[model samples]
Target: MKKTIAGVDIPDGVMAQAATDLIRGTESELMFHHALRAFLFAALTGYRENLTFDAQLLYVGAMFHNVGLNAKYERSPYRFEVDGANAARDFLRRHGVAEREIEEVWVGIALHTTPGIPEHLSALVALISAGVQMDVRGARYDEFTAHQRDEIVQAYPRESGFKKKLIEAYAHGMEHRPETTFGTVNADVLDRWDPNYRRLNFCGLVLGSDWPN
Candidate 1:
C-alpha cells in the first residue's frame, strides 16, 4: 500500500524501500535523518496551496533526491551528484514510474546539487535541499549570513497578502535551518571516508537520523 504523509500519497512501497536502502548505504545516520527532514519540509511547504503539478513533482523529487548516493560513492565517488541522479532515474524506471515523471525526477535530482536552475518546483526543491545539506553540516543560515535566502526573499518578496501567505508557508520550514554543532557527531566516522564525503556529510545534516528503517 502507498504511504501518505502530510497529504501526499507516495505510490510505490518498493521504490520507497529502494530509496531508503540507497540512503542507508551512506552509513551516516545524520545524513539519512536530514534527508528525510528535507523531504518532510518540502512536502509541508510545497503543499501549502493547491497541490499544483510542479509542487507535486517537487514533493516526489525531494523524497528521492539522494537515492543515488551509495552507487555514486562506489563509482566515481566525487561525482555523486551525477551518479545519484542516474541511479535515481534507474530506480524510478525500475519501479514503474511514468516516463514524464521520471524525467522530472531526473531533473530534480540533477539540479538539486547545482544552483541557477529555473525557479520552478525543481529549483525550489534544489534550494531547500541545499538548505537541508547545510543543516546536516551543523551550519545555519541566519538573516544576515543567508545570501541565497536573501536572494529568494528578494525574488519573491512579500508584496501582497497572498504573497505573504506563500512566504509564510515557505518560512515555516525554512526558518528551522540547522545551527552549528561542535560537541557531537551523529554518523559513523567510517561513513565519512567516501569520496563524496563532503556532499554526504551535508546531506547527513539535512537527513538527520531515522532513515532506512
Candidate 2:
C-alpha cells in the first residue's frame, strides 16, 4: 500500500508503472524511483501553493518534469531540463493537452533543474524537483563517486552550505548512510528522504541570487 501526501495519492502501482516507463531498458530502478518520488513531491508542493495559472497544468508539469532524465543522462551529463522539456512537450501533446498548457508544462520542465526560472507555480515545480534530486543524492553521497559529488556541488554552489546541512540532516535521519529498498515505492521514501532538503536548498539559491561571494 502506497501512502498519500498533500492530496497526491502515490500508490505502488502508479510508481511501478512510472518506473517501468522511466527505466525502460535501464537497470537503475532505484534511480527511477527516486526521480518519480521527486516529481510527486514537486507536484504536491506546487499544488498546495497559491498560483495564478491552472492548477491542473502545474500537476501535469510536475508529473512529467523529469521524463527525460534517464534518456538524456544516457547521452549526456544529466541534461534533464532541456531533454525533459522536449519530452514533456511531446507527451502532453499526445495526451490532448492544449498548446498553451503544453507550453507551460514545457517551461516548468525546462527550468526545473536549472536556476533563474521566474517565481511562479511552474518555477515552484522546478525548484521542488531539484530539491528532490538533492534529497536522493545527499543521502547516498558516499555511493556517488567523488567526481559526482563535486559536480553536484559545482552545479548548485549557491545552495552548497544549506545542501550540506540538509545532507547532514538526512544522514542523521538515516543513521549516517541511507540505503535504497527495491521492489516497492512509498511515501515513506519522501518522509525518510525529506523534501525539506530541497526546500531549504531552493530558498538559499533563490534568496541569494547574487553569485556566491
Candidate 3:
C-alpha cells in the first residue's frame, strides 16, 4: 500500500519501488530512512511554496543522493555528490525517463551538498536542497507545523546521534578522494574526522596558478 505522510502521497510506482529497493539494499537503515524523510520533507516544502514538482523524480533524487557513500564508491574519482548523481542518471536512463528530467535529477543530487547553489537552480534542485538542509540541519524548521514535523519524524525516525553518524558517513565516503571535497562543505567533514586532511585554500590556488600576473 502507498503511504501518505504530511499530506504528500509517497510515490509507489514501479520505478519508485525499484528505487526504494535499491537504496534499501545499498544503504544502512539509518540512511534509508534519512532518504525517505528527505523525500517527505521535499514534498511538503513544494506544497508550502506552491512549487509544482514531479514527486517520483524527487523521490529518486533523495534516495540516491547519498548512495555514493556506500563502500562500492570508496575509490570513485569524482565527488560523492557526483557519484550519487551519476548513479541516479544511469538508473533513470534505464527506466526510459526523458533526458531533461534525468538531468534535473542529476543536478539536484550533484548540488545537494552545495549549500546556496542548488536553491537557485530549479524547483527540483531547490526542493532537494531544502529537504536535505531541513532534515540534517533543521533549516526552515518553523516552516512546517509542529504536527507535521512530528508526523514525518514518527514515520521515519532519525536514529540516535544521527548527526554524528551522518558526518561519519560523509567522511567515510570522501576520505579516499579528499581532493573532491575542495571548495564544498564536504571538506569540513574530512577536516574533522581525518587527521591528515589538509584543506585547500581557494585564494592560494587562484594566486599560485601558472598565469603571468
Candidate 4:
C-alpha cells in the first residue's frame, strides 16, 4: 500500500524501501522522521510548482541528505554534505542504479545546504533542497497551505526544540573537521556551538597569498 499525504504518493519501490530502511535503522528517530518529512515537503513543492521529478530519486536524496551527521563520519575530512552525497552514491551503485541517475541524487544531496543554487538546477535537485529548507529553515513556508503543513506535521511531528537541536547536530558533525566547513554554511554551526572555532575568511586568504597584489 502506498502512503499518500498532501496529495503526493510516497515512493515504495524496492530501491526506495531499501533506502528508507537503511536510514531508519541508522539515523536517530528525530533525524529519521525529519528525512520523511523532507520528502513530503519536497513532493508537495514539486506539485505546487508544476515540476516533474522522480519521487524515488527525491526520496533517496531526502533520506540520505543528513546521514553524514552520524558519528561514523565524525573524522572525515569532507564536508558533511559531501560525505552524505558520497554515501548516497555508494548505496545507489549497490542497488545497480545507473550512473546518470545516481549523479542527480548526489548533486541534490551535496547542494542541499548551499544557500542559493539548487533551485536553479533540475526539478529533482531543486526539490531536495526545497524539502530540506522548508523543514529546517522554513524557506517558502507561506507557499504551502495550512492544510498541507498541518498534515505533514501530524504525520511526522517535529521534536521539541527542533531548530536548536538541528544546529547542535550540525555542529557535532563538523566540529571534528573544522577545515571542511570553510566557505560553507556548516561554518555557521561551528560559530554557534564550537567554542574556540575560528572561521576562515576568503578575503584574508587572498590578501595573505604569496602573490602580492
Candidate 5:
C-alpha cells in the first residue's frame, strides 16, 4: 500500500517496490516498519525544510539502507551500511537508473551511519542520514510538529518492541564482522552487546605520541 507523510507521497513503484518487498519478506516485522519510517521521516525532513531532492532516490536509500542487517547480507564482512548501499546500487542499476543517481543513493546509504559528514554531501545524502537518525535517535526531531509526527508514526506504528529488536538485529548482523562496525554508530552496539567487542580510542594515540612541545 502507498502512504504519505508531511505531504510527500511514497507510491509503490519501480524504485521502491522491489526493495520493500525483499525486506518485508526477509527481515523482522520491526525492521520492516523501521524502513518505512525511515522514508517517511526523511521525506518529512525534506518537506519541512523545503529541501529539493529526488524523492525516488531518497526512497530507494531509505528502503534499502539497512539491508546489511537482513538475512540476505547480515553476515557480510562490510559494514551493514555498505551492504545496504550495495543492495540499493544494484537495484537501481538493474532498473537502468543512471550511474550518477545510483552513486548518489549508494553514498547516501553507506555514509548514513557516519555522523557530521552526509549532511554536507548533498540533499539526498543529508536526508538519508537525517532520516536514519530520525528513525533511530530522533535527530532534528523538533522540526516535525506534533501532528506531523503523530501522522507518520500512526501510519507506520513503531511497535513497543522496536527499540530492543532493532538493536538486537544490528548486533547480530555485525557480531561476526565487528571490524565493520568500527568508526560508525554500529560500533556502539558492539560496545554494548557483543561481549568480545573492543572500542577504539584516539586518546591512546595522543598519549603515546611524543609531543615536541
Candidate 6:
C-alpha cells in the first residue's frame, strides 16, 4: 500500500518496516511533523523542477535527516549532520539497499544543512535542503500557494514555540560537542546557549597564512 500525503504518492517499498518506524519514533512531535512537511516540499520542488527522482529515496532522506537531534545520534563524536547521515546509511545498509543508492541518501542528509551546495547537487539532496529551507525560513515561500502551505501545515501542525523548540533541540544535540557546529547552521545553537562559543574568523586565517599573499 502506498501512503499519500498532500497528493504525493510516497514510493511503495522504500520505508515500510519496524526499523524505520523505530528510528522515526525517536524524534519529538515537532521534528516528526517537520519531517513530513519537508518531504512534501521536496516532492513539490521536484515536481516544479520537472526532475525525475526516486521518491522513496527522497522520502527516506527527509525522514531521517533530523535523527541526529535525537538522543541516539546526539552523542556521537561526529557532527549532528554526519550522525544523521551515518544513521541513514546504516539503516539502508541493514535493509540491503543498493550501495550506490545508500550513498545518495548519505550525501543528502550530510549536506542537508550545508549552505549552498546541496541545491546544485542531486535532485534527492536538493529537494531535502530546499524543503528544509522553505519550512524553517520560508525560503521561496511565494512559490508555494497558500492553500498548499496551509494543507501541509494542517497535516503536520507546527506547534506553538516550534522555532524555540528547534533551537533547543539543536543545542541539545550539539552542546557537548560544540566543535562540530563550527561551520554549519548548528553554530547558532551554540552561540545562543553557550556564551563562550566563538566563531572562527576568516580574515585571521588569511592574515596568518603560511605563504603571504
Per-model TM-score versus the true fold: 0.48, 0.45, 0.97, 0.97, 0.90, 0.90
In candidate 5, which residue ranges exceed 4 Å CA deviation?
Answer: 203-213
Computed on alpha carbons, the lDDT of every model, listed in order, comes to 0.46, 0.46, 0.93, 0.92, 0.83, 0.82
| TM-score between candidate 6 and the true structure | 0.90
User: On a 0 to 100 scale, what is the lDDT of residue 74 in model 4?
Assistant: 72
Clashing pairs in 6: none
Q: Who wins the lDDT comparison?
A: 3
Candidate 4: residue 115 Cα off by (Å)? 1.2
Clashes of each: 14, 1, 0, 0, 0, 0
- Say which prediction, candidate 1 or candidate 5, comes out ahead on TM-score: 5
lDDT of 4 by residue, 1-213 (tens): 989888878899999999988998999888998999999999999998899988898999999999999999977988889999999999999999999999999999999989889989999999999999999989999999999999899888898998898898888888889998887788888998978999999999999999967
Better of 3 and 6 by lDDT: 3
**Error in Å for residue 83 of model 4:** 0.8
Model 2 C-alpha lDDT per residue in residues 1-213, reported as the tens digit of each score: 645543455444433354346444442333344444454444443444443444345444445554544433444333345556786677667667778767776776665544344344555445444445544444323533465445433432334355454433323323221222111121233345655522224466667898766
The local distance difference test score of model 4 is: 0.92
Runs with alpha carbons beyond 4 Å of true place in candidate 4: none
Q: For each candidate, C-alpha RMSD in Å? A: 15.6, 15.3, 0.9, 0.9, 2.7, 2.1
Instruction: Tell me how far the alpha carbon of residue 204 in candidate 6 is from the true structure, in angstroms, after superposition.
Output: 3.1
Scanning candidate 2 in windows of ten residues, the lowest lDDT window is: 177-186
How well is each residue in 1-213 modelled by candidate 5, as lDDT tens digits? Answer: 666666769857865677778778877777778888888888888877889998888888888888877766655778888888887888899989999989999999999989999989989999998988998988988877888888878888899977887888888888888877767888899888978788766786577779954
